[model samples]
Target: MATIRIGLDRLPPAARAAVEAHTGPLLTVEETAEGFNSEIAARVTSATGTWHIKGLRADHPRAWTQRREAAIAPFLTGLGPALRWREEVAGWDLLGFDVLNGRHADYAPGSADLPEVASLLCRLGETPCPSIELRHAEQRLEHYVVRPDLRFFAGPHLLHTDLNNANVLVGDHAAEGDRARLVDWAWATRGAAWLDAGYWVIWLIAAGHTPVSAERWAAEIPSWHTAPAEGITAFAAANANVWSEISTADPDPWTLRLADAASAWYAHRRTG
Candidate 1:
C-alpha cells in the first residue's frame, strides 16, 4: 500500500530543525513522486549540499523500513546512493541520502537502458551479503510457495527483491562500470542470487516484454544460469499468487498490471 505523502515543510519544527543541522539552511525542497514506500520523499538543498530525504513517523507501522535502509546503506557503496545522515526526533525517523543525478530506468523493449540495468544487476550479483539482520526470501514466499520448493529460494547472496524500474537510476556515463544505481533498499533480502533476476522478469513483462523475452534478458545475468528450470517455474507461480493478493487488497493499476504479468509468466512456465 502507498503511504500518504507530505511535504518537507509539513514536518514538525523540531524535526525540520534537526534536518537543517545536517544540511545548513534549506534553500529549496522538491517533492518526488516516484516511490510509494516513504511518506516523506523529497530533494532538499542547503548552502552545504543537496540530499534526498525520506522519513516516516516514528510510530508508523513501516518505520522499521527506515532502519533497514540505514543498516544496509553502507554495504551498497557503488550499487546504491550513499546514506549521509539519520535523525530520530520529534516523533519521526528520517534518513538523508546523497542525491543521484539520474533518470529512472527505461524497461521497454529496445531501450538503451536495458543493457545498463543488466550491468547493474551483474555487479549486484557479485556483492557478498552483509552479516546484518535481513529478511529471508524463502520465508517471505513461504505462504505462497510449497514447502518443498522453499529450498530453491534459499541462498547466501544479498538480494534486492523489488525490481520496479523506477527504483533503478541510470546515470549519464554509459561506458563507466557502475553507471546505474538502485534506490529504495527497504525490501532488501537474503536469498538465492538468481531470484533477483526472476523478480526482474516480472517487471520486464509489466513493461511490455513477453515472458519468453524477459527470460532471455534474465539470461544476461550470469547467476540466472544457477537457477534450475523447476525452481524458476515455482518462483513464477509464487509471484503470481503474491501479486494476486496484492492486487486484491489494493487494485491499483500498477498492481493489477503486475498481477496480470505474473499470471502470464506463470502460465508460460507451467505450460512449457
Candidate 2:
C-alpha cells in the first residue's frame, strides 16, 4: 500500500495513526505558505470524503508551539468554525479543517468583511496568553533600546506579534456568514497592543496603501515612547536603564523613523 506523507511521524503514536487512517492515498502533499513555522498541507481521499491535513513541524524546542492550534481551537469554535481533529496514535500535531476554497487576500480595506476581521482580531487579543514563559519586559526593552540606531516604545499588552496580511484568509460564505477568517496563531505574545497595530500599519504601508504618511508615521513614534512613562511610572522608572536598547534590532526604516520621532517626543516632554 502506498503511504501518505503528511509529516506526522513525530506525533504520538495514536495521533500518527489517526492521521494516516483518515488520509488515505494522499493524492498530494506540500508545504503551505501560511507561517514561518514548518507546515505541510496534504490532500487525501477516503470512503467518506476528501480531507485536508495540516501538520506542523515538530522539530522545535517549544512543545507549546505544536499544540497552539488545538489549544485555541476550542475557544474559537463558536467565534469562528473550528475544524481541527487529531488522533493520539499519530506523533504529530495534526489538525484537519475544511479546506478553504478561495483566495486568502481577496478582502481589502473597503471589503464588507473588514470590520469582522478587525473584530476577530480584537476577540483573539482578548484571549489571554498561554502560560509559556515570556521574555521579561525589561529584557525586551533592553534588547530593543540601547542601539543608538533604534528607538523604543514601552507598554504592557498582549499582541499577536505577527498579523501580516497573508495570514488572513478571505473566502465566500453563505449569504449571511462571515467572509473572512484569520488563522495562524504561532507568534502570539504579550506586549504592547499598539505593537500589533503598528506592525499591521507598517505592513499596509509597505503593501502600497497610504493610510499613514511618512510624517504622521514619524510623529506617532514619540507619543509611543512617552506612553509607558505616563501610565506605568513605577515600571518605567525601574526599567529606564534597559529602555535605551529596545529598538536596536529593528532596522526597518519606518521603525527607525518612529524611534527617532519618539526620541524627539521624549525630549520635548521633558522640557515642556
Winning candidate number (TM-score): 1
Model 1: runs farther than 4 Å from truth? 174-177
Candidate 1 lDDT at 178 equals 69
Model 2 regions lying over 4 Å from their true place:
1-16, 23-31, 43-45, 49-52, 56-64, 78-83, 87-91, 106-116, 125-142, 146-158, 174-177, 211-272
lDDT of 1 by residue, 56-149 (tens): 9999999989999999999997899999999999999999999998999999998888988898999999999999999999999999988999
lDDT of each: 0.95, 0.47
Candidate 1 whole-model C-alpha lDDT, 0 to 1: 0.95
How much does each candidate deviate from the true structure in C-alpha RMSD?
A: 0.9, 8.5
Q: Pick the candidate with the highest lDDT.
A: 1
